[model samples]
Target: MAAQLNHTIVWCSNRSASAKFLTEMLGRPAPTHFGHFDVVELDNGVSLDFADANAQIQPQHYAFLISEADFDAVFSRIKDRGLEYSADPMGSRAGEINHNDGGRGVYFRDPDGHYLEVITRPYGSSG
Candidate 1:
């Protein structure tokens, strides 16, 4: 079998809050408590395990590919929560979504300042 991502630990001050932020922003299921992590499982079988950081937390970026309909729903939630969003990863254009690769996408920061993105299509998928 090919190697694939199993899980990754996201260091934050509060695992519960970070996990809940991810789940709510991405429309994912609530995280389940594990030995040292709040595991947020994706449909692809990969899980994002949230853990408390021992040192400074360097922000990271995470992107998700979803359907157009799901994008609308999730985007609505983003706005309803008054979360700032941008059309680009650098956040040059705020409060706007990108139509890259013929699909919609937006970038926002998690409670821990991790850049989170949702794209309706994969990058370079336009054909």
Candidate 2:
């Protein structure tokens, strides 16, 4: 078989909280404990293993390609929670969503300050 991404370790101050935040944002099931990590599995079989760390963490970016309905539901939750979002990754266009490549996209931050993005389509997929 070809090489595939199985999982990645995410460094966070609190593994459980970070994992739960990601799962909830993506409307996925709750995270499960695996050893010292909190694992959040995606639909594609890849998993994010969140581990607690005492050192300072550098924020990372994670983007999700979802359906329009899923985007709507997630966006609604974002607004309801009063979280700041931006149309662009740099966050200059705050409180807005982008229609990039003819699909909606938004960027927000997780509890550990990781940049999270949700989009209805892949970049350059539409003309």
For model 2, how does the per-residue alpha-carbon lDDT over 1-127 read when each residue is reduced to its tens digit?
Answer: 7998999999999998899888888899999999999999988889999999889999999998999999999999899888999999998999889999999999999998999999998999986
Per-residue lDDT over 10-115 for candidate 1, one digit per residue giving the tens place of the 0 to 100 score: 9998999999988987788889999999999998999999999999899999898888989999899999999999999888999899999999999998888899
Least lDDT summed over 10 consecutive residues: which range in candidate 2?
17-26
Count of backbone collisions in candidate 1: 0
Give RMSD to native, each candidate. 1.0, 1.0
> Given candidate 2, what's the lDDT at residue 102?
92
In candidate 2, which residue ranges exceed 4 Å CA deviation? none
lDDT of 1: 0.92
Q: After superposition, how far is residue 1 of candidate 2 from its true place, in Å?
A: 7.0
Cα lDDT of model 2 overall? Answer: 0.93
Query: What's the TM-score of every candidate structure?
Result: 0.96, 0.96
Residue 51: error of model 2 in Å? 0.6
